[model samples]
Structure formats: C-alpha cells, structure tokens
Target: MKIPYRGVNAINSREIDKVLILSGTFGEGHQQVANAIHEATQLSLPDVESVVFDFMALGYSYLYPLSQYVYMKGIKKFPRLYGYFFQKTRKVNSFSIKLNAVLSPGMGRTLKLIQEVQPSVVVSTFPFAAGVMSKLKQYGLINIPTVTIITDYTDHSYWIHPLTDQYIVGSNMVRQALNHQGIDDSKISDTGIPIRPKFFQAHDKIELINKFGLDPDLPTILVMGGGYGIIRDGLTTFRALNALPQSIQLIIVCGHNEKLRHQVTEEFKHSKHRIYLTGYIDYIHELMAISDIMITKPGGITTSEAMAMELPMLLYNPLPGQEQDNAQFLVHAGVAMLAENLTDLKTKLLHLLFDPKLLKKMKENTRLFSKKRSTFDALDVIVQMKRQVSIPNFSVTG
Candidate 1:
C-alpha cells in the first residue's frame, strides 16, 4: 500500500496520526521522555492524534519484569558491569544485529502498525528501537521518517545506527560521543530531549500554592527520589528540615511505588510539620512550580525539567552509569549538589535552607544551563528530514 503525504491519508489518517512511541518502564526517564514528546506533539498540533505505547509489554510478559530488574538492580549493585555490557556490544556482529532486528518489539510491531495507521513518520525515544529501525530502513520495509531521541547523556552501542535519519542528543558531549562512533555530524542534532513546553514558562509559587491548596506562608521542600522510590532516608530528610523552627511543608511524589508511598505517608502522619505524600501525579510541573528546593535523583528528564523551572536540585546518591554522568554534569555546572548518602543528604538540605545566598546562586546557574527552545528545534530538524525524504514520492503525486 502506497502511503501518500497529503489528501485523504494526511487528513483522515490524521485521526490516527499515531506516532508509535516505543519505551519501557525500566527507568522513569525513557517513559518521561516519551510522554513529554507525546504531550508536546498533541498540544502543539491538536488535530494530530498521538498514542504512546510500551514496547516491552507487547511481548513476553515474564521477560518484562526481568528486564526492569536487571536494569535497576544492576545499576545499584554493579553499575560498571552493566555499562560494560552495552559498551562492549554497541558494535556487535551482523548476526546479533539481525537477531535484534527480528526480536525488537518496536521493530516487529512497527511494520504491521504502519499498514494500519499509515503513519507519515515514526519517532522513537528508546534505544532498543534504534537497531530495528535501522534494519527496516535498510530493507525498505517502509520509508517513513525514523528518528531516535537519546534520553541520556552518555552514548552506548544501543543508540548507534547508520540507518538513523536523525539522532537527537542531550548535550554536545553526546553528539561528540556519537561522532566518535563514526556517525556523520550532519545526522546528529544537539536538540535536547523534548520537554513539555509548559516548563518553559515562569512558575508562580503563590499561584501554584493556591491551585494545590497549599499553605502560602509555609516554605516547601519537595522530596522525589525517583519514579520508583529509592530506600533513601526520607524520614531523616524531613526531620532535618523540620528542625528549622519555621513552618515547612513537604511533598513527596512516589511514582508507581505504592509501598514506599505508604511508608512515607505513615511517617509524615506522625510528624509535627505539614507533609503531603502522593503515589502518582499527572501535574508534576505544578508541584515543581511550588517547590522551593527539590531533593531528588538526577535523572535526565528530572534534571531537564528542574532546569526548565529554574529549581535548585539537591541530588541524593543516584545510581551509577548514565544517572551518575547526569549528576556530574549538573554539579560541574553549579546547578546542583550531590549528597553522599542519608547523612549527607540531611546536612546538604540544612545548608541550603540556612544559606539564602547559595540558593539564589544555584537558581541563576540553572537558568544559564536551561534550553527553552529545544522542542521546536528538534521538531524542525526531523520534520525537515521527513520532508526531504518524502519529497520524491510526493513529486510523483503532484
């Protein structure tokens, strides 16, 4: 079936303008990146219908949890080992590439979805989708614009692909990393990962407080370890903040981790200060707006969002690999501080609260690091590529 660029396809097919978003639940950043782009795409073009789906959950029900476990547990216990695996296999043999192309859930699912939705383009946020897209483009399964959004600072073999029409990088370092892998500079765009455009706007603390029914007078500290809660000393962090003698409120967003959310809620119920704990929330942008300081892990999306909001990050001991590299970049740029563990986490919070000058400096540094226009810059590049690739086909129709 010939997929036309305009007419009934572009108009009626737009009802399913479904760009397949391939991501897994291993870490929060991938899904967050997918959702950020998904939301931006929908909000920017309301007529365009977008659907986001998990790649792993589509196949091998039991293997999905195992994949998540190896990623999260491997990072915490043996990060270097996990990093070594991807590093060593990035340029694996043709046999592995073909096998990956055949097995990748995105690769297998995308071909059939194309026949049904007839997408004008395919955008992927996960690295697992890269190899398959490259393979399909090589075989000419379907020629739609295929782009990959690198969600981390470091580049592994999983992201390298000659068939990738565009590689969206998080930083110059990542572009350099890809270039080192022999990809032409022309193919890489330093368009930071897509973030919700709302983050680019000014956040009003007073307005957010009123919206969330928060006490305006109480100084607020937001503790978010990660999407899946970490075993950080949440109670200790809260206690140290409570010792300040000033009225303080804490909001803990425990994403998808019900046990951790319950434990934190119980601890807060017995505490003297006002504290709020939620399992999952859709409007973290609002939470970040009202939060004075964010105590959390330095995942790429979280760091990017914090930068967008100009909020200071008090990073706890983040797991190794990409997150560690992400933490280092923020600390080196003077936008955040990294705590060694629970004790240091408490001390770091106390220092920030007491030193007003220090907090102001961090905020200023964050503004310098923030890239407010990355969304459009990235979209512009890929859309241009899609137009370039689709032109010859459209010329015949014209």
Candidate 2:
C-alpha cells in the first residue's frame, strides 16, 4: 500500500487515474505550465483526471495576496533589488537554506492535501511546491514519484531537491546548468517548457486579419505586456512607434488594465497610423498569426508561444532577472532582439521593420528552435514513468 523512499514501488498503471499538479501564481508562467500539463493529460490520457492546486493559496492562505502584491511591486519599482536577491540566491547558500526552513510552516497543509487527494503521481510547476514535496518524501510521509517542470530557461538552486525523481527542462542549456549543480544526467529531460495545445494549432492568416479588421497590406506589430499590461513607459513606446517613417499598423493588447487601455486609446485616437487597442482577450494566438513582429517583454510562456507560432520577437525592456536571461538566450539564438531603452527600442524596431530578410531569418530560426509538441512530450514522460514502477528501486531517467 505504501511506497519506499529510495526505491521504486510496484504501482499498477491503471491505478494512476489521478494526477495532482502543484502550481503557484507568483507569475503567469508557473500557472500556465500547470494548465498546459493538465490539458495535455486530459487529451493524451483521457482516463487520467488531472487537478491543479494553487500551492500558495492552499499553504499561505492569509499571506498569499500580500506576498503577490509585494512581489509585483518589488519587481516593478525596484527591479535591481529584486534582481540582486534573485542572483544572490541562484546557488544554495545559508540564507536560502534558512529561508526554505522558515517556509516549512506551510508543508503540513500541503501534506494534508496530498493525503486527501491520494494522487498516483505528483507534478510540480512551482519551485516552492517541489521543495515541499521533497521534504515530504524525506520525512517518509509520502513516496509518490515527483516530477518538477522548470518553467524558465535557466535553473536556480531553489528548484533542486534530493527527492525529485525527474526534471523536465526548457532547453539543454538548463539541463547542463543542473548537471553542473551535481544533478545526474539520467534524471533530467530536455523537453521544452510545456505550452497549451491551442498554441500549436495553425491559423489562417488572411481569415484572422479579416476577422480582427486588421490591414492585410501593412505589416502588423503585435504589442503585449503580460497579463497585467505592465509595459514600462507604454505611452512613450506608442509615441515612438507612431513617429516611425514606415507606415504600419499596431495591435496592442492591454490585458486586464482598464486604465492602460483607456490611456492608449485616448492618446492615439487621432494618429495617422492605424492602431487598434483592446483589453484582455483570449485570441492571442490568432493575433500572433496575423502579425509580422511582436513587441513585448520576454516572459517564458509568451516567448515560447510566439516561437511556436514562428513569430519573431522584439524584446523591449525586460525585467532584470529571469526575463533578462530569457531575452539573452532568445537574442543569441537569433530568434529575437532586445531593446534596452526607448531610443534603442525605436531604432531596433525601425531597422527590423525595414529588413524583411532579417525578419524571415528570425522566423526560420524560431521554427527550427520551437518544440510545439512539448506538452505532449512531457505527458509521455510522465506516463512512461508511471508504467516503469516495476522494481523496488527504479530511476525515471532516460
């Protein structure tokens, strides 16, 4: 009835009917990955019922909202301070260890949830969830084969744990980074970060253009600033784009930011260049399909979705920590370019808009680099791991 801590316990594949996905809403990427995994499981393994639990909400009920607020404000107002702490905690240090220990008050609730759910396998999309699960395994309270899907392009010490059976990473670079941290090559799989299946589907560009009332003749620039519409100096960026000599249309999606939407609409109402501004909508994939270039921050999920659609990116003013790292990888990979300031952003956008050849090359690179079926690939790995629990001690590594 119970599984051992260090060895594989024989579990019937048919009994793995439930999957518990632990996620956090600190940022959109973690929750998005969790949703992708849940959708993938439903589609590929119809027999399996997948459930996602918000780790922060369940564990830190009273403080979750305040913590999220602090995180957003910290990153937006003092990115350098946040970046300093992020980099400082990149590797295991005394501070991080103590911090994890301090966070142990929530582990009891997490364990209670696991016992109630009685899941056959556990998957973690949040680093803190992974830590809690590892601690549970360490204490012999649970023996589920835990998988940690790292959503970012880089690896951090916070995601590492002795009891995590497998790690699904976004790229080989992250895998190598983990390997350098003493993680065995066998325990890591370089399955690109999981994305929603809808992102992988093809859309008719002409149909989308007509449906959205976009100009099919002029190049369309799709601008986004994550779910909260936190584009830095958004009005200035709009002004710069409007001043460009090239005649182009703009589609700006100010997600859930009513003030931003109103401000942009009022500011650009009488502009000569055609501009369309809207609030949050679910049809981002279609918008991406009809656009030539995307001007946005380099959040992992958004960047991955754009790559899947073969849309070249113009990364503008990325946040200092993971966003910066994501932008660097994308630029070096030739799938994207970065603009650190307003002047640089304007110059880069104009150049990229004029250079069709460069745009085509970037699109080609994105096509080559994208793993559209990453969600399914990750699902397959989880399924295979569930089936391989035939011996007392089995490794979930390839």
Candidate 3:
C-alpha cells in the first residue's frame, strides 16, 4: 500500500516531505503536543506536510472510549491506585513487558496507517504510539526516522524503547533521568515541551486585561483544570480562596467541563471578589497574560504554557503519577509551589500573593527556565533527522 505524494512542488522535490505524528488521548497533553508540532511544522517548514493520527482511535476504536473512562475514573476516584500502578511500572519489569506485549496486536492498524501515509519521519507524542513504533522498527517493518517527544517532566520506562532514533525531552532534568536509565546522551534533546506559537508571542498585559474585562490594578489568580476540567476538589479550593482577606480577582477557565463550570459559577455568584468563569476557552494565553499567578493542576502542557507566560504556579493537588512529578520539578526549580490540601493551598496562596518580591523572583526563575521556541527547535530536529536518513524498504511480520 504505497501512498501517493500529495504535497506542494517543494515537498515533492525533497526526499523527506511528509511527517506522521502519532498521538493518543488519555490526557490532553499528547494531543496538544501533536497539534503544536503540526502547527510549527506548517509555519516554519512549509514544504513539510504533517499529519496527526489519533493512534488509539485508529488502532483500538472499540476500546478507546472505555480506556478513557477507566483512566479518568482512576485518576479522579482512585489516584492512589493509579500512583501504585505508575510506580510499579516506573522501571522496566515483567508487568510492563507483558502490558506492551498485550498492546502489540493493536499495532496492525498503526502499521497500516504508516503504509498509507508513507511519511519520511514518524514522531510519537504518546507513550503507546512510541512503543508501537519502536516495536514496528524493531521488527524491521518500518525504516522511517522515528522520534519520541517525552511530554512530561519525568522519565518512565514505558517511554524508553530500543529502536527509537531520537528523543525530544522537556528539560535537562528529564534528559538526565533518561541518561540514568541508559539512554545515550546524544539521542536526547532538551528542547522543552512543544507549545503553540501563540504562547510564544508577546502581548500587552494591560491590553489583554482590558480585553478580558479584568481590572489591571487588582492582582489576579488564574485557575485551570486540564482540557477536561478534572481539578480535584476545585470547588472547595475556590471557596477557600474566596474566604481570603485579600481583595483579589479570580479567573477560572474550566476546560470543556460544563458541570464544573456551572458548579463554580453557582458557588461564586455572590462572592465578594470579582470572579470570572468561563468554559473551554481558546484564549488561555490572553488569560495567562493578565494573571499574577496560576492555581491549577500540573499537567505537562498546561505547566509549560504557564512557564512560558512566566506566571508563577500554585500546583493545587496534583495527581499521583506524572502530575506529581511535574509539581516536584517545578517546586525544585523555584518557579512554583505545591499545596497538597485545602489548608496548605490557602496558606501558600496568601503568602505568595501578599509577597510581591517572592512573586518577582519566581517570575524571573520562570523566565530563565522557559524554552520559548521549543516548537521550532523540535521541528528543526525532525528536519535534520529527515535530511540525514535514507528511507529503506523494510518487511512487516507478526
């Protein structure tokens, strides 16, 4: 199944022109990174035609929704259980090996997609996709250059595979962790997590504040859940913050969770301070621009966006696995703080909001830490890999 070339003249002239981005939807981070990379490739490398495929939807259509439900239920109701499983599989073990083996049957559809796309380079933003691509390459079924973008701040054995040609990591710490896991230093590039270009662009703070109907003089706190608005105890957190002595403004962006949005609106309708509630907004960059600090869960893409905005984060009740790791990294970096419960959240938020100097220092740390052009940097790595590699005719087998 050879895919016919359907790109521009410049693309047709080059040996490498198409990019296949494989992503999954267990969390929004994977899909967001896939979209960021696709946008970046289109903007910077005009000749490259990037295609994003939802690997789970394509490969396991029957189980995708069920798997998502289980994942969400686990995170929301059984975080400790999720954490236990996460820790158990943190290192390569028999359980992890068996899990990968069980998932291998689904890779047939992925292999078929590869046959149809005929891409010059394959990139995976999801661990499952990476594992499948690694297995395919290991079996000599695919000869395309394969890159895995680690979307989290930590390293896990599930992300490490034998046949991946390169790795794009979020930070030096993640790269170091990967090194300790035996991945070659040269294969890992600390390009940061890829974020949309809009986040990289400068916007006027006052202008954005005015645009959002926010008072420029008042210190604003931005609250967020990931794309699904799965912030644990979000209403309680808000209630506690509203009880604070300071006259602060709050802007909560509840992403695609109408129930959460309605609950928050009803809960804060008569609050003393100015509270802005919105659902699934596309202008997070604008909201981040006007806020003094963020109270949110520490998902990789969201945290990366906050860091890029140089907005100090109060990681409120991060979940057990990657979110916990992200919180630890940010706290250690001094650009963020962690609040495990309601009492701690109130205490930390008050101290940080009242102390202007501390906020400035955190902002400076964020400025030093952010990788503003990581999207472009990741694209550059892909283009370079494409230029250096020669596509080979390979055979597929079960």
Candidate 4:
C-alpha cells in the first residue's frame, strides 16, 4: 500500500486532489469538527477535495447503532462509570491498550477505501479512526501522512498513536499534556478546536436581534443542551432561570430533542420574560451574535464556538470527563463560569445578568483565548504534509 511521492505530486497538480477525513457519529462534536475542516478546505483550497466518512459506521455498520446507543445512554444513565473509565484510560495503560485494540477494527475495509480514494493525506477527527490509522501505519500497510485532530480541550491515551505524523489540539494545556505523554513537541500544534467559519465572522447584533424578533435592548441569554439535550436537571435549571428578576430574552435550543422542546415550551408558556424555544436549527451563529451570555454544557465544539463569538459562558453540570476538563480550562482562561448545581447556576446567572463589567471582562478574555482561525490553521498543517513520507515507529510509552 505504498504511495510514491511522485504519485502524490501528480495528484496534487491535478484540477482536484483529495483529503479523506475520518469521523464518527458518537456525538456531534467529532462530526462538526470534520465538517469544519471540510468547509475550510472548500473555502481556502478549492482544488483540494475533502471527503468525510463516518468511519465507525462504515467499519461496523451492524454494531454501530447499538454502540452509539450504549455510548449516549451510558453517559446519561451512568456518568460516574463513564467518568471512571475516562480517568482510568487518560494515560497509556494496559487497559487503554486493550481497549484501543478492541476498538480498531476493519483495517482491511479502511485500507480498501484509502486505495480507492487515493487521498494525498488522511485526517482523523474521531479517536477510533486515529487508532485504526495508527495501526495501519504501524503494520506497514499504508505510507500516507496521517494527522489526528483531537476535538477536546483534554488529553487522552486513545487520541495518541505511535505512528501519527501530526497531532492538532484545541489548547496549549492539551499540547503540554501530550508532550508529557511522550509525543514529540514538534508533532503537535495547539490550533484551537476547528469550528465553522461563520463563528469567526462578525455579525450585527441589533440586526440579528431584529431578524430573530428579539428586543435589541434586552440582555439576551442563550441556553443550549448540546445536540441530544443531555443537560442534567433540565427542569430545575429552567426553574432557576425563571426566577431571575430582570427582563431578559431567553433563547433555548433543544437540539434534535423534540420532547425536550415541548417540555420547555409547556413550562415557560406563561413566563414574564420573553422565551423562544426551538429544536435543532442551522442559524446558531446568528443566535450567538445576538446573545450576551451562553448557558450550556461545555462540549468542545460549543464552547469553542462561544469563544469565537466572544459570548461569555456559564457552563452547567458538565459530565465528569472531558467536559469537566473543558469547563476547567474555560473558567481558568476567564471566559466562562462553571455551575455544579441548580442553586449555583441560578446564583451565577443572577450575577452575570446584573454585572455588566464582569461580562465585558469575559468578552475581552475571549480574544486572548480563542483561536478564531482554527480551521484555516489546521488546513495549513494538513496542506504542508502533502510531501510527508512514512514515519518510522517509535515508543509511545514514557
């Protein structure tokens, strides 16, 4: 499965070249990151064709549904167990190695796809895809340059591989953590999380507010529960928000969760404050523009988008894994506040609502923390690897 450099050059010199991006549907974050990179390549380098595949679904079509069901349900139904495994596998341990082995399957199918696509390089936004690519490179089955884009602000053993030529991360903290895990500093770049280009663009808040039928003068709060509406104590959190005295505009996006949308609609139908409820929508960037503060779970993509838009965040009830890690980084960077319970959420919301100066400071902090050009930066790295050759295997255990 060796692709000659001359062949790569010939392909690159053509009207269109290919960069295969491997992603998964376990959550929205990975797929979002993949789409962001795809969109970037389309906008920045028109000649480079970006193809995104749900590698897990492709490799295990029959079992993917069940696995996805378990993953989503496990996090909500047994968060402590999920967090325990996450902590246990944060490092390159025997357990993690066994788990990676079990997770990396259907290399034959993967190699076949690579041969057919003949991509100049392979990019992985999913950790399991990284594992499969690493194994393919390790066993001398493929020689193309492979890059792993870690979608979270935290470091984990599953995202690291011995043969990956490059690693793109969301923050310096994650880069340092990977460096500590024995990855060479030169192999890693902290380019922030890849998000849609719209997030980086400026929007007229007043115009957007009018477009959405929201009052321009009122303080706007955007509440989101990620793609699946996994917010813990959702009813209680809404009750807390309802207690706020100020006349504010609340936009609640219950992504793809019709039941949650109905529940919220029924609960807030008679509230004094202006309340707007909806299911999944494509105009989140516009919503973010009109928002003064965002109250949501600290998923990697969501928090990154908030920073890009300079919308201060009040992160609520993060699950005890990478989300908790994301919340810590955001709070330390002065861009977000973490709320552990309903009472804390209400208190923090009250403080943020009344304290304009604090909100201003948080907005200022975003410029210092956000990588607004993350997609383009990641593309820069990927484009440079067009000439990358086979990387020799090295010890990952430190």
Estimate TM-scores for all models: 0.83, 0.92, 0.94, 0.93
- Predicted candidate 1 versus true structure: per-residue lDDT over 199-279, tens digit per residue: 887777787788777888776788786777653454565556556555678888887778777766766676777777787
Per-residue lDDT of 1-398 in model 3, one digit per residue for the tens? 11122322233233447888888878788988998998898788877888787877777788879978888777899888888888898888999888766764566777777776677888999888899888888887887888999999999988999989999999999999999989999999999999988898899998888777888788899999898898898678778988988888999888878988898888888888898888877789889988999999999999999999999999988888898999999999999999979999989999998899999999999988899989999999988777666664334744
Off by over 4 Å in 2: 1-16, 103-105, 388-398
User: Which ranges of candidate 4 are over 4 A from the true structure?
Assistant: 1-15, 390-398
The true-versus-predicted C-alpha distance at residue 91 of model 1, in Å, is 7.1
lDDT of 4 at 120: 78
The TM-score that candidate 3 achieves is 0.94
The C-alpha lDDT values of all candidates are 0.71, 0.83, 0.85, 0.86
Quality of model 2 by C-alpha lDDT: 0.83
The 10 consecutive residues of candidate 2 with the worst lDDT sum are 1-10
Model 1 RMSD in Å is 5.5
Ranking by TM-score: 3, 4, 2, 1
How do the residues 1-398 of candidate 4 rate in per-residue lDDT, one tens digit apiece?
A: 01111222233332467888999878889988988998888898977788788888878879989999899889988989989999999999999999888888878878767766677789999998999998887787777889999998999999999999999999999999999999999999888889989899988887877788988888899999898887888677787788788889899999877877888888888898998788887788999988999999999999999999999999999998999999999999999999878888888998998899999999999999999789999999998886565332222322
Q: Which stretches of candidate 3 lie over 4 Å from their true place?
A: 1-16, 103-105, 394-398
Using lDDT, give the best candidate's number.
4
Ranking 2 against 4 by lDDT, winner: 4
- Model 4, residue 223: distance off in Å is 0.4
Which stretch of 10 consecutive residues in model 3 shows the poorest summed lDDT? 1-10
